[model samples]
Target: MWNHFDTNGTPRTNNNLEGYNLKLNIHLSIASADIFKLISKLKIEEVDASLKYFRSAKNEKPPTRNKLYVINDAILLNQKQG
Candidate 1:
């Protein structure tokens, strides 16, 4: 489940989710928010994810990957094929 070599287009790691969690923590700005506030923030996240999904389904490209990651992916692809 952790491997990505045979799974094209799948995330190679949970970096995206980690980044999202970091962003959420920053937005919350509190170590312990009330239940209602937490729910509100989660709803916002859900809406954002849904919008991104729809945009992707419509062929709108998501943000470009970092150049370093792009290069690494290319290298891995070459190694996998060879």
Candidate 2:
């Protein structure tokens, strides 16, 4: 039911979310972390997200995507246009 045809320059997959989940899992380092530990990690993520938001708000350019992704995006754009 999801359509990304008109959503140019946006991700077409959940890879980013999956990557974040993997990172969080590694940081937790346990199958079942204590509630307090989970809360602390969540707070850290919140602060990191806030910092990125503020930086973007100040007109700072975000980090570039990987070269592979850049190429893939170009190809997809060409396909969409043609």
Each model's lDDT:
0.85, 0.86
Encode model 1's per-residue lDDT on 1-82: one tens digit a residue.
2266686877788998999889988988899888898899999889998999999999998898899888978877887888
Candidate 1 accuracy as TM-score? 0.79
RMSD per model, one decimal: 2.7, 2.7
Error of 2 at 33 (Å): 0.7
Model 1 lDDT-worst window of ten: 1-10
- CA error at residue 71 for candidate 1, angstroms: 0.5
Name the runs in model 1 displaced over 4 angstroms.
1-4
Candidate 2, 9-42: lDDT as tens digits: 7778899999999999998899988889899999
What is the C-alpha local distance difference test score of candidate 1?
A: 0.85
Q: For this target, which candidate reaches the highest TM-score against the unseen true structure?
A: 2
